[model samples]
Target: MKYILDFDIAAVCISCITLFLFYERKQRRFGPGESYGRIAWTVLLSSVFSAASSYFANALPGTSGAATMATVTLFYLFHNSIAFFAAVYILNYGGLLPVKKTMRVLLALPWAIAIAAVASNPITRLISYVDSANVYRRGPLFFILYLLSTLYFLIIIAALFFKRSHYRKSHQRAFLAAALAPVLAALIQGFNRGLMLECFGASVSALLALITIQNASELMDGQSGLYHRESFIEFLAGAFKKKEPFTVLIAHSPELADLQGSLEMQNYRALVAQVSKWMFQASGAGAAPSWVGTGVFGLLFSRRLKSNPVGDLALKILDLADASWSVGSLHVKVPFKVTILQCPEDAADISDVVDCIDQIAEVARHSAHKKIYTKFDFSVGKHKRSSAVAAALERCLERESPELFYQPVYSIARSKPFALEVLLGLSLVNNEQAFQSEVLSTAEKMGVSRQLTELTLKKAFEWHAANKQELAGIDQLQLRLVSSMCLDLDWPRTVLKTAADARMDLSKVCFEITETTVSRFGNDLAMNMELLTGKGVSFALDDFGSGYTNLVKLAPMPFSIIKFDKKIIQPGLQSNKGRQLLEGMVDIFKRRECAVAAEGVETEAQAGMLALMNFDHLQGYLFGKPMSGQRIVEALKNG
Candidate 1:
């Protein structure tokens, strides 16, 4: 009874190493995605135990009796358990498992029966055998164990492949590839008995799953050896959870296509690979560079290795990125721009930081300047960053640094602008193009949104009165109100008073309410809305197609205008099914005597499509970008 090195022992060693590494990596997972880790670890442990027990079945002690019988039968039991539970893991990961815990347990009944049979096999001698020669091997009944595992693996592979849309593509590929290993190995081994393929095959597949999913993580991006967008977000989310502050410098390559177009695809790929490596090297040793888009790179730096106010750092990184790419004397200067956002300064949280960066990117895309830095333009810059932003917004609202600009909503039936939406202008610190929603959100979070709204409306009324003679051609002035603000039970009175006090007509104003605000407010808001409608204050459902809306929800509400959200409308204009859906909505609204408007109509094609669908109004950059009150007055005077 000398111990020997065999395939099973080798398999056990490999599985043990994989599990050890897996548990080590498991220490870092946070919040979500922890469930996937639990599933993977469970599958690994079951596979490990299965491999461990198989060792004794491949060998025998010089003595044979109950000890041999016990050891051999345990192997069959572990193998049976592996077969049953591996399928369970697959079903669970694929989200095909039963909802009820009792049903799930019932589903495991067949595996339990197989385990019981193996347990009683010492007398039954069904799956395991200790022959007269004192050597142990799998009996004819053991083939059933392989059959079960094979069947399950095939089913799992087929399920994942066929239902590919249900899963993340990365996860689907990994599971499909991993599931193929053991089943394929079983088939190969069925042809040749001497090949110890199943043990190593299963171990390698498990390791593949671990590396592809649980381990590769934020540290690596597949084979590129660079961080990806998801990794950057994951890493930053973890950092934010720990209250760790940092700056993100995003660089977008505007001329990446031009550079790639000049070269062969393979050479361009190689050039990008070199550029990625250069980015990592240039972004300071402590900084992490992630490929956020095909032509964009993001460098994340913590306080330990960087300074606050990352404008200078962003310029430096851009300098590094925009330099000439010398590939065998073919130098290509990449035209790019960098957008810098400091956390807890520009944004209070990770979500806000993401939003700020997105807005900055939008500005950068439209900006004619080669370089732009986000620094405060207001005198309140000396204050704390978050406070300064909030104060700057308040000051912007009160003083009308930019003021309420008007974007005319073109009426298709009239073939002219019948109304103009009063969009709040942003000319705060840095003269940045601030998102209205974000600014108002900051105001709301700071308990000043109500005051801000009042200030904005008051300004709008003042401008409307001064230009009332000039703006007589324009029929209505649309203003936006959040559900909370709209349903405050006093907004209806405030609307009438504000207009009356300014000597501006309340009959000419239409208030747009966001769907999210409406859905969140329930019946109380509907009652308040009806009160406004009764007073001749026309209401528009803003961003209609963005949220869950149906006749049941929309019928009770008092709405005179239905403004289609850009996202749902844009696609509907492109596809027949989507167009039909939009047509149905337009028809329903038309029947209800509601004027249908489409928001974010940026193209002639979009305007034409919506016009053909009998939409009444179109609002977007296509008609006119939101302009200062002076600009609107000038346009009116000139005409």
Candidate 2:
């Protein structure tokens, strides 16, 4: 190789390697994103021409043949075109530029400028020249091209600096470094014309940017080597767009958080690695296993596989995870909940799929038996229905629209009521009530649970304040809050603020928490409950004796009431022995100074039995079905 080919050969080799690394980085089965794939091709082609353009300089004045001149002209044209293309890609990668383009031709202006110069360069020789020694020399107009090229570098830095707040510190540093690398090289080579530096510098800088940042695989968890939530969602979106028949199985270990707290970080990482290895091995090339959350791994597989039903696939994953592994002499068995959903079957849209998975995962996580669940299916029409529901709900909130309803909890001693349980639910477009909506759930998953809770509370408080006078005894109002809403750190404060705004006594308000919430209790729940209980706001253990109601864990809870779930109540109302069990549970709660209520009392016989059992309250259609706030008030007046 000639001494002149040193930088050119180095640039070509580095560019080729960078391109290979870019392609090799994606371990996802879903493939790269459109923008990501486009940018990769631009970078590869740009780097290739950066090296190729160097050779045209060797064809000099002695080689006056039109063929040589044409080759040199074409090389510079391509070289300059790629230069501008690379700058645009960098801007795109840095997220400093907008993704949408109404007119793609509008973006071609920079390339057009470069091409016009290259087209005119042969007649003018402004961009290049053949020296007397048959060597290449820079023309006067070459400085203008150089200026435009360097301007791209400056634009990248300026754009990134403007949007510095949008990026993480590491990303900001990497991108700035990537931009500066070529500029500094251009400056050095400009001072010493014999030293070729710009192409070589840009190639190395790209490699640095690839390794340090500007990588999609950076979406993977650093330790686990699996897709993080953001990347997994991106992968999911691609799958949805493809409309390919595929099954997504999510395994979430609620215990992972606890384990992370208990073990050393290094030991925890090692354990995660072991679990990931199991996931990969179990997947066996057919499925792309990704760590979606703390201990949640999602396996995505196309339908064209040798497989049984989704239930069997879930079972195999469960059995696969059941294997015991040790982390620093500590033997651990990871028990996880499996929730599976199939595309175009369960859901076709990305949002519906996410909502379905999240809802099913939540149910399975707290379930008494973590059986393979496949019940989360939506018809083709349901996607539009769900979107309409979300939009209707959003409109409802914006208008301060209230969907307030109340179920009467009656005193068993008389036919009169003990309290009215306020039930505010999201009304769908079809006027069907979905108390906990997928939109709300998605908000919770996205950490906007606080805002969702605030919106619900705001409307509820508004309705209550407006009807306070008509509602007579407002103190008898009890609210049933979703567990996910309570998990928001701001929920406690929101409750206090709403209560103050409504001019309601906190002591008179009661919050009912279901067994589902209590069983899967976290620190957020514990803290929020304390905030309420501290203000003399009463709590009722709603759906008591439901699945996973661990009485031992419930010991320290500040519950003033216990309402028996229909699962417990119906069976108790069935047999004499079952009735005895019910009485025994009532006695246990009474001993703890909690008022006990029997729910689902649909019969006069059941009502008599509940009354005889000394249950403090009875709630069922036999007393009064849930109705609008106005009807509830009218009913109270009539009674």
Candidate 3:
């Protein structure tokens, strides 16, 4: 039987090219780098051995039978080994590989049996033997090698079938083609041994594995040189499904947002690469970190109880972030907030983990300095609930059915409610203030703050219009407005038009802006306030003393009222210096002709003290909790 060396030579060349490509590729440690590595090398070896066996079998005419036998044996050995390695790779890729040593050994038993049968072939003369002319010939048990290859392909197919949901359609096709290529080539060679197609099939499988699994472009972030978000999610879901315990350290850099386009491209890449490399090393998990968002990077490492305390890890990460990074001529300090989440311990699944990451990253973006967010600060359940409330609120806003409640701001001197503060109510969230914070933050993130403001304004004006008699005694109807609305020059016109459409009295309306908003957009907000103030709309500085508020900046603003946050009022009730500070602020506002209102006045003592301090409007539970418009009308009528 004559053997063709042309196909063998071509297969060897293709295999070499595949192996070279795999070697030169940028490999991610967390991916199937090692598995694809073995496949590449093994396929190259298989092709080389197959070509050598063909050479020696026909070329070593009537001289050295030992060389022919050895080469033939090696060709079959590596050919079978290719199938074995590919099967292991697929199993691991599907996250079906057993973690236990015993189970892993059981999984490898068939490949081990194939190795044993091939090794004992020279004496037993069962697989391949050198004939009298030094030509390779199939033995009695030669089909055993084919059977083993078929068995591995079957296992791969079964895994692909069962784990179909785990991978995308493109990946499923790649896996299927990779597994089927070798089997189809084997079938072709099995029917005609002279065809020499097995090595070609091995080359095809190597190319597929290299392109699809080993060095896939989707697995990496171009800027950070880390795994991308989709890859991270897929890896995390696999871990969750396997029930493997791990800890994730998610760090977000707020400075990255500011430094985005300022630095040169090379410097930006270098900075991101430096941070990613440092994070991967700090994780100690031998896996690559991932770029989850613009400034968010997530490090998922194996959980070690004794060695790796999540708190200490978070501190170490924060400390590393504190170091100054030199990017070209720029010496920048990128602040990072690290949040720690434990698998199965902190989160129920991958969805919860993702929600927790978003919530913490959002908090980190707003925070000023390096901080660590632990499970205690923001738990999975709390994040999920906040997410649920945000989702529900979004739906409500879209439907234009946002629920609003009114809380009375009682007058200390007149002993009557002087103002009604409108609060956005969410039955999903228990606390009124928390609900407002969530709505504002959610609206900002969802890019619907303007929609929320417009809806709330329209609703408040309509309520006031319908119940004009009930609100006649109230001096002001206060509405909380987000700062983004003030950035628009036409925001005042929009507010006035909404009030006009509802036929509500604009003089009876007061818009409240948080101290944080005033500090951020003081110039724009002041202009908007002045515009609205000229049209008989009052502006109140809400949540004063709870954020970064500058007194000098506040003086230039046209706010008619100052509502102190509970953080200030509660502390004022506890200490003498706090009371002095409160009195001084009140006196300053009084001189400015701004009516100072004390919020969160829950008890008689708080109300009495605030009243004594000459707080014109006293608010909180002492006056009345936030109630619906109808309930507010009833409360006012009953009083």
Name the top lDDT candidate. Answer: 3
TM-score per candidate, chains pooled? 0.42, 0.58, 0.66
Ranked by lDDT, top first:
3, 2, 1
Question: lDDT tens string, model 1, 179-244?
Answer: 778678768877766555666667777677677755546455543456776766765664555456
- Local accuracy of candidate 3 as per-residue lDDT tens digits, 471-568: 78988889888878877878888988898999988899998988878878878778878877898988899999888788999988988999999988
lDDT of each: 0.68, 0.69, 0.80
Shift in Å, residue 137, candidate 3: 11
Task: Provide backbone clash counts, one per model.
Answer: 1, 0, 0
State the TM-score for model 3.
Answer: 0.66
Query: Which stretch of 10 consecutive residues in model 3 shows the poorest summed lDDT?
Result: 25-34
Off by over 4 Å in 2: 1-6, 16-59, 64-67, 70-74, 81-101, 108-166, 183-197, 214-289, 293-406, 411-418, 422-564, 570-597, 601-617, 621-639
Question: Which candidate would rank higher by lDDT, 1 or 3?
Answer: 3
RMSD of each: 20.9, 8.8, 7.3
Candidate 2 lDDT, tens digit per residue, 164-281? 7756788778767877777787788877765667667777776786676646566778878776767667667656655578878877676664688999999899989988877777
